[model samples]
Target: MSARWRLAPGERAVWLTATTLFLLVTAAWLEHQITWYLAVDQFGYLTFAHDLLAGRVYHEWAPFQWLARTIPPRTDALAQAYVYDHGRLYCRYSPGFPILLASWIGLLGDDAAHYLNLTLFLVLLSVLIAVQWRLLRSRWRALAGTVPIVVLPTSVYLWALTPTREVAAHLSAFTGLFLLLRAGGRGLAPWRTAIAGVALGYAASVRPDAILYLVPATLLVAVHLRRRRSPFGVVARIGVVGAIGVVVGLLPALAYNWTATGNPFRSTQGMELDQFLAPLPRSEPTPAGGAVGYPSPGWHGGTTSDVQGGGLRLANLPRTLPANLAFLIEAYTPALLAAVVWGGVVALMVRPLVFVTAVPYGIVALLLYSCWPRPDPRYLIGVNLLLPMLLVEGTVGTLDLVRRLAWRGRVEAARRLAFVAAAGMVLALVGAFALRPSTSFGRLAVPILLIAAGGAGMAATWPSRRVVAIVAPLLALTLTGIAVARAWDGLDRRAGFQRPQMLRARDTFRRAVEPRAIVITTEDIGRPAENIEYYSGVAHALYLTDLARWHGSVFGVALLAIQAGVRPYLLLPVSDPERPKILKQLAGVFSLETVRDIPPAQAVEYFVAAPFHRGVHLLLERITWPGFEKEKQGGPPG
Candidate 1:
């Protein structure tokens, strides 16, 4: 807004140095942690690429499609993140991401799918830096103020390792800010507004509820146009064009649902809402046999959920809101928490445009998820992009506050005490890390260092001093390195935890059946992960969730499979204590033998905040009823 906001020589040097460090750290993290195949919903996106490559518009992979049609257990079977309808398997997620991934897969082969996120990460970071510079008009604040990508470790994992759609969501958000700024004071550049609307719509394809990204952008445009003295007719036309752009962008998603699920409005997500949240009638079970749960085979009972009422209700706000916030705390970096607090002032109070959208959208996003039956922290990521910008303005706000305090000529002794306390804490941290790096506190120095350095550097930059300018980015990079190191440790820790389970699942799946055999697992365990159900069918690993609603009875379905002339190996988890009782339950339907005893995780983790691992052992079993081999020559090979 003024020439005083121009970057200084020292600040330029700091921005350059920090950017270089950030790139190196990012490259290292990608190299160290990235797996070859996408996980979770990204897995479904990957599989869709196959159909796209084959030139089919709506999942006409005849072989797999045929299996779903001809298969006997069709009534109770479908892949995760997908809906099975009349002999066809449709991925529930919109294909916006899959189209991007498919292009990479087609051009460079399958491994390129994993690198898409890395590609998007770089693009997203570049967008953040560029947008922050334009917003703050200073190179130095832009980098650190953009919020170190590692400031939220969960974000690192979510963006770098989760869905590329999420990275696109963040990119669109920051880009929207730039577009709106440029579009303001204009004589109705409806195209700019329309493009921004399109970006938001595409993101919502994957995150159906991510339409909240539009709230801020729309507010800014309407307010900007009205303030510019534009006619009501012109403003209304721009609004209509923006709305049209969203509908145009969503055309693919709408077409997909119509063709794949045979219902234009139905989504697997909506189906889950009914399955997981729909309540059973209190007096008598609803016609659909109550909300489905995968109860452990008759031997033992699983968690009887303590839900009083089912589905999303306003009454649950008191309980869900606190739970969602608690989950957020567990996932966030300390630096992010501080940014949210200090930077929040800028977002909510100082900037009318920022507050107009940020407050409403953030509140809506958080509240929407808070009412969810199981709100995962990643759901809030779209709105979380605003925090970094707010942090940039927050530094300016803080500087202004400091100048005002200095003008007031406050007590010198109080200032000295504050400086001494800060110095003492810095020394204590340095001493702990340097002297005994293996101590619990030292081992956890990264987040701790991040908390101290990132919080201090962002809150008080002392822009006039060259030493402080140099030190600010040095501190920022140090915080980045600390977060990277912390994240690296987490990545390694999860790999170690998951290795045993993944390898065991892989090995068990490979040998569970003969050349043409099918294995029905308690969960969908494919080549690498259960969550990646796209590969489960290709690997011949099925799960109970398919038939979970009808009745989660494993043997009930197992008998149905046998009657239909197909035998599926049952992969189950057995409690050593309940081993005999579980076996008795299985004996009732058909004689069974435990083929393999997969061991549990070997060691417990201590330092990591969330230790990802399998605590229970699993068993691979084969049914041994009479005439089990009579249909050996039938069905496709595993």
Candidate 2:
């Protein structure tokens, strides 16, 4: 028999813990995949990957050679990007996520991106849990760690599923923090310091906001080394090495930005956003037959009109802060909040180093992004992943304190009272959930009742140590289950990864219509349309608004599409009243023909705007396109 067949009890227990964690993390990954939602960020990242694969930095949506022939010149680069990049532009985002995604797509193909992200999530979760286990090993700590991974916050899971830098940022930030803490305990070896510095630098590459943690973390390392009475020469050398590692990590992002946008520091996205946000004169006539003026454009995709009004200004910060804070609070669930409190308490008592590990990143993130005119939690998902670690640490520390107290034979009666109080508190939490109150009085009464019950329960029970241990585990399980249920419920309500009906319609239309033609939407089709282009394998589709500043009409757009000698299909929702007006304008300009009619059942029925069939046939016959022969042979012409 193999010697591997024998195992000690402790070895078996370790394996068991690892196996259980693996299974739980796997389940969480599966749950997120089932939802399989894509958002604007996912769309942008995936499109960028596709463009890079196609041997281009930017995807050309439509020919802009004739842009000047039709529309008046505009000085705005943002407007120019809309006309040129065709809204398939990749801007306002760090390149790390997209570049990583591109590598995955190159290996497996487009459909593989989602699966690869799921795999990444598994690896990241495993690393985080392993690190936490090393730092604080206990039943409560394990359970607390499991809670965040199992029932991730809505923002957290969404970023995890999408190919965004947030996941990478989290991985690097937490890993760096963990390494620094380890170095703090066991003297900081040169290699450990260098590796930690690289990790932090890479984190900043993933998200600029990560610098908030990196700057402070670097300082902590230097201070710790100095306090250890290391030679000044050694300290300087360490600092130099770490700084070099950081610069090495940051080189790729800086080089790519410089090459692409001609500015190593920032992309045109913010400039474009500023132009879009600024109240500019309408170059085109409005529907009422005059140029439109605006304090802010009433468009959705560009920016938040409600808050910015006309432009992003200092005044808008205060107006948007409340909503942003609310979103952040909701995203950080009550379970997590309690854990943070407990973890903070514990960190204060036993592990001062732990507070600096993950908590600072979260605080910096909260303060940094609170001023954003747009309240998107996606940008700060790294912080979301870090705060939970603190909670786990706190809970573990508290449990360890209790265990120590019990072993010392001190506060026997006090320990019994504490258990009774804890039990009563758990029961009160259950009651609060059961009778979820709408009124202020009900909210006040529930907590008041819980406090009163805990005081009364402390005076009543004298449970044994074994009983307390069993009850605690049971409570952990119950709370974890509730957390998971709430996460699922929140996901269902938000529908982040949903829009099945719209996707079904897009797929149905692709199948029913011509396979090789240009699809242009009458209005600014948002993520649903972008989803079709990236995920639905419909690369030929381009939004009409993106083609030109049509300002409220699709006349110049149709003319341009016709001039390019491609079939121009105008897509509009069947229920849209604007469809009739658009069709009439197209008829007045060019011969209108129905290429296909998508039924309301399969899709929101839409019309295909094109020249009459006979006219198109004659036009093609007279054209004698040079590429026709190669197209017939399924190859590009030389």
Candidate 3:
């Protein structure tokens, strides 16, 4: 008889407690690290929430507005505000993340939105761990599956501070996976299956890529039911129940798209149109006459504009699989590659059904992501969650073989020596990552330590399956916490090591905006635009994109009609390598208009220019040239 069949109560409790603590610490540490490192993305989310609360229907001008609708408004005043009035009508992006952000905004204030996102990320991670534990029914396997995720180098690094669509997408994908696994088999209860359906539906809504899992999950369940030879009525009932649950879960997204875009299937068309329209110049050259004219240019082959066409091509293909795989490998850290391969090998052996289910989902995710012009690592975040579970299966299967050999006593010495060697490798890897923060080292080291430690801890208490179960989770959690701490310190140092231009950008935005005056600057001002919009409640005031030129024309006309006295508050010279002539022309024009320079620092000279043609001399007076001496001392803002 296998020794694991027997177990004790005290050993179980210790293991359980340790595992719980480890997960808690790791989750918290990762949350902190990601929040700190990538806080910039939250500005974008907050902008969406701010718009949603105001009730603007459009997703363009602001992407991810769909996520905002999930949260109820916090105040009646906020709820009553018109979306158009708040600048939401012009938003141009998907609404999934915005809807989610909005829900948090309603429950908590705008200030708490990022925290809510972080909390959601942690919750999703916890749920994934719990689900893996339940499905595998092995402590070691579950820990092995979850530890990589908790300490996943990229996952920790990205999660530190950005409340991005990628984060939400990951959460949604995990929820879907959990639901699919929990619903499709003999061990699942009816209620659990229904709940799983709902989760799957919600995941699909957050990221359309998750929809690919539905076909596989449904087929898997249908096959399971068919083999059981249940009555026709039972099958019919299950179908209806699952369908209803899925429809109900999807209703929110369906209704949102239907109301916002006229077609439930289409994303925010307004946003897409805005992106398409914004890229085209106001004027174009007449091919017939060597003369520049209106209607700038139509869409050509480029990264962002080709997304739809790419999606179409991606929808049909076996040839594209290699490209998709390459994209996935490149987007994820090396650790994921090792984990996926190891986990895949193990999953095939231990739970072939899960392996099968995961394969299609991964394939679809890769293909869909590859089709995108921008292949951000965050896009594949959730898809990678399944890897940990696979690793768990692989580790347990290997350990089982080792246990059998140990019992035979024929190769126990060799096994022990191999274990020691593995331990040394893990320690060396971890030490390297701790000393040097390379994504490669971190990814390789974390999983090695986690798998090694988990395997060792389980073996020590094996034959007592209960004890192995308890210790596995604890060890996994401990490793995750250590990785988190390490990640946090590394991120902090990176964020702190900024150039002088970055510092100047931060400081310039802080002082530029006053109560009601609009602050106009060139687009692509990097962190400065974010700072101005965030610090100053002046979203309309700071025009950073090319869209600002259009807005400026309108403002210029209004100023001319109203005879409203406009003055130059601050002007920062925009440096561009590709368009040096344009930059020079802009500078000469500003100087001709008598724009003054305000010296902020030795690095950046701030200029004050008024609205041209409306009180042109007052615009000149507002613009002070800190003189040629100041210009000579400080080069343009980089």
Q: Please, what is the TM-score per model? A: 0.72, 0.71, 0.65
Tens-place lDDT per residue, model 2, 1-638, is 23323235775564456446445545454544433333445556676677777777755544344443444342221222221233333344566666777889899975577665556666576666555654544343444454554454434554445555677776776677566655124677677777877777777776666767775477567557766888988888878877777776666567656755667776434343354334334452222111011011212232222112233334335545666666544544443355466666666566555565556656666655654455555655666666666654543344445554555665565476456546644664674567533332132223333433443243334322323233333334444554545544544342224345345645655664454445555322222344445545442454443443334246665555555555455555455565566667765345545555444333331212111111111110011223443455688863
Best by TM-score: 1
Q: Local error of candidate 2 at 409, Å?
A: 11
After superposition of all CA atoms, the RMSD between model 1 and the true structure is 8.0
lDDT string for model 3 (1-638, tens) is 23442236775675567566655665555444432111234455566666677786543432113212322231111111112323334222345677788888898875565566567766766776666655565554555566566455434334534555655755665565565554223444456557767766766666555566676567656755766776787777777777777766666567666765467776542232233323223443222111010001221112222121222333223434554455445433344455466656655665566566565666666666654333334545656666656645444444554555566674555367337534643565555555634554455455555655666555644532333354455445555556556545554433221233334543554454333333444322222234444544432223223222222232332223122322333333433232344235335323323234333232221221111111111111122233332454586632
TM-score of 1: 0.72
Worst lDDT window (10 residues) for model 3?
A: 287-296
lDDT comparing candidate 2 with the true structure: 0.50
Q: Candidate 2: lDDT of 458? A: 37
The lDDT of each candidate is 0.52, 0.50, 0.47
Task: In angstroms, give how far residue 366 of model 3 lies from its true place.
Answer: 1.5
After TM-score superposition, the amount by which residue 95's alpha carbon in candidate 2 deviates from its true location, in angstroms, is 1.6
Please tell me which model should have the higher lDDT, number 2 or number 3: 2
Off by over 4 Å in 3: 1-8, 31-44, 55-90, 179-191, 223-227, 269-339, 400-478, 481-511, 522-527, 539-638
